[model samples]
Target: MIYLRRMDYTVIVYHLLFHLLLLTLGFSPAFCFFSSIKNTFKWGVQSVGNAVCSGVNCCDFHLNDNVEENLTKLLKDKLFGQHIAASLLVEALSSHRTHKSQKALGIGLHGWTGTGKNYVSEMIAESLYKQGMRSPLVHVFAGRASFPDGDEVKKYRKDLLTWIRGNVSDCGHTLFIFDECDKWPVGLIDVIKPFLDYHSVIEGVDYRNAIFLFLTNTGGSAIGQRMLDLHEEGVIRDKLKFEDFHDEISLSLFNEEGGFFKSDIIRGDGIDFHIPFLPLEERHVRKCAERQFELKGYSNPTGRMIEDVLKNMLYGPTSNPIFSMTGCKRVHSLVLSVIARLKLEL
Candidate 1:
C-alpha cells in the first residue's frame, strides 16, 4: 500500500514538473495538448477526404487534357501579358475561396467582332464548373431582358441590378457576363457606378463578392483615346495609351472618332477584364476549329476547305482570310455537309 501511494505521488509530481517546464519554455500546457489533438484530427480528415476523392472527382479532373495544357500554359505567364483574361478569372475565383472574404474582380473583354472573346469566356466558365467550383455564371442576353428598348436606360439598369441581386441572394459568388457593354446608355452606366466600384448594396448585404466580365467589340484604338482623356497624362502601366494601334483604323482616325464607335470605359475596381482575341497560331486555330466542327456534326472537311475556313475565320499571320460569312452560314446549315461535299465519313 505504501509503494502504490508513493508511485501515485511520483506520477503526479512528474506531470506537474513537466507542465512547469513547458510554461518556462513559453508554452502553455493546455495549448500544447489542444494543438496536438487538433492537428491529429485535421490530418485524419485530410487523409480521408484525399483517399475517397482520389477515385472520383479527382480522377475526372485529369480527363480534360487539352484544356489542362492550355490553362497550364496560360497560368504560367510571368508578365501576364498573354494571359490577362485567365489571370483575372483566377483572381475572381480566389476571392471566393473558402474562408476568404467578400472581395470581387471585374474585367472588360474587348476585341474585334469575330475575335472569339465570348467563346473564350464560355470556356473559362465551363472549366470552373468542371473543377467543382460553386461559382455561378449567367449569360445576359439583352434581347431576352426588357432593357434599353434603344433608350430604356432606367429599365436596363434595373434589370441588371435585379440580376445581380438574384445571384448574390442565391450563392456566395457569381460571374456576370454583361454582353454588349458598349451599348449600355451613359445614364445607365452612371446607375451601375456603385456596382462597378463594388459598392452596390443588395438588401442589407454589401455585394462585394461577384466577378463581372463585360465583353465588347470596341477597338483598342478607341480605348487608348478614352484612357488619355480619363487617365492622367504620361502614365504608363505595362501597355501604352489605348489610342495607338496598327489596325485598319489609324490612331489619328480613332482619336478623331473619340475611340471606337461603340467605346466606353470599363472600370475594373475589384474585377478582372479580358479582351480575348482570335488565336494567332495556325495550329491552335486548326485544333480549336476541328474540335468545334466535330462537336457540330462535321466529321470532316477537305484539307483545302479546312485551310480555307481557317483563313477566313482567322485573318491573322499564317492564316487565310477564306473563311467568310456565307461559308460559315453554309457549313452551319446542314448536318451532312461534310459527308456529302467532302466525301469523308464521320
Candidate 2:
C-alpha cells in the first residue's frame, strides 16, 4: 500500500510540471516581441531609402517641380557674395558705415502671419546649406525670457543681444532667419545696431556673407481694415472679400513662461518672383494622383478625381491665403494629410 501511494504522488508532480511548461510556451509574448522588431526593421529600411533619394523625384518632401530659375540664381549669388546682411529689423543695418567690411546687405520680407514667412526662410537656408554655407545654418529661436535686467526697455535690449550672441556665429558665415519678427521686443531693434554697424565685430571677426532675414507680419494693419471697409462700402462684390487679411498682432514680450510662438501670413512676390503655395498645377496634381494609384497597385475615382479632391481641399472652400506664418502651416499640414489618405485610397 505504501509503494502504491508513492507512485501516485510522483505521477501528480510530473503532470503539474508538464502543464506549467505548456502554459509558458503558449502564453509567452514572443509573437508581439517579434512583431515589434520586424516593424522597427521595416522603418529603418524606409528611412535609408529616403536619405539615398536626395530630393530627386521624392513626393515625401513635396518639392516643387516648377522651381523658379531666378530665385535659384539669386540664392546662389547671395551664398557666394562677401559680407551680406539682410533684415527689416532696422534700416540702420543697411546704411553706409564709415567702415566698408562691416557693412552687409539687409533684406526684409514682411507680411501678416500665415503668409509663409518661415517657409521661405527654410527654403533659403536649405538652398544655402546645399550650396555649402556650413553647419548650424539655422538657429532655433529666442525672446524676452533671456532678459530679466530692467523694465520693458532694458529687458528688450538685453534679450536682443542675448539672441544675437546665441544665434549669430562667432566663427563661420551663419545666416540667421529671425522668424516671427513682429513678436520680438521693440527695444531689441537696438541690438540689431551692431550687425548694422559695419565697423568692427564687437569681438574679432567681421560678419562676411552673413545675412539676417527678418520676417514680420505687422507691415500695415490699416490696409487690411480698408479692404474690409471698402467691401462693406459696396466696392467689392464677393461675400468673401479680400479684407480678412488685415489685423494687428502685438505679441507680449514680457514672458514669465517660456514656449514657442507661431504666426500666419500670405506670401507671394507678385507674379515676377512668386513662390506659389502649391508646388504643382492642375495637370501635375492629376499626374500625382495617377502615380499614387499605381503605387497602391489599384485605381479608383481614377487619379484625376483624386487630384481634384486634393486641389479643392488646398485652394477651394477650405483654403484661405491670408494668414500668419503659423496659420499657413496648419492649413498646409491638413491638406497634406488629406492628399496622403486620398493617395492610399486611389
Best by lDDT: 1
Give the poorly placed runs of model 1, Cα more than 4 Å off.
Answer: 1-84, 95-102, 130-139, 143-148, 198-202, 220-284, 296-302, 311-340, 343-346
lDDT of 2 by residue, 129-205 (tens): 44322234445343333333335756665655665665444433456655545555444444564564444555764
When summed lDDT is taken over every stretch of 10 residues in candidate 1, the lowest stretch is 322-331
Q: Taking the tens digit of each residue's C-alpha lDDT, what string does model 1 give over 113-183?
A: 43455555565555444442222234454322434465565677687677676655654345566666555
Which ranges in model 2 have alpha carbons more than 4 Å from their true place?
1-102, 131-134, 142-156, 159-163, 166-169, 220-328, 339-346
Cand. 1 TM to true fold? 0.51
Q: What's model 2's lDDT at 337?
A: 54
Predictions in order: lDDT = 0.46, 0.40
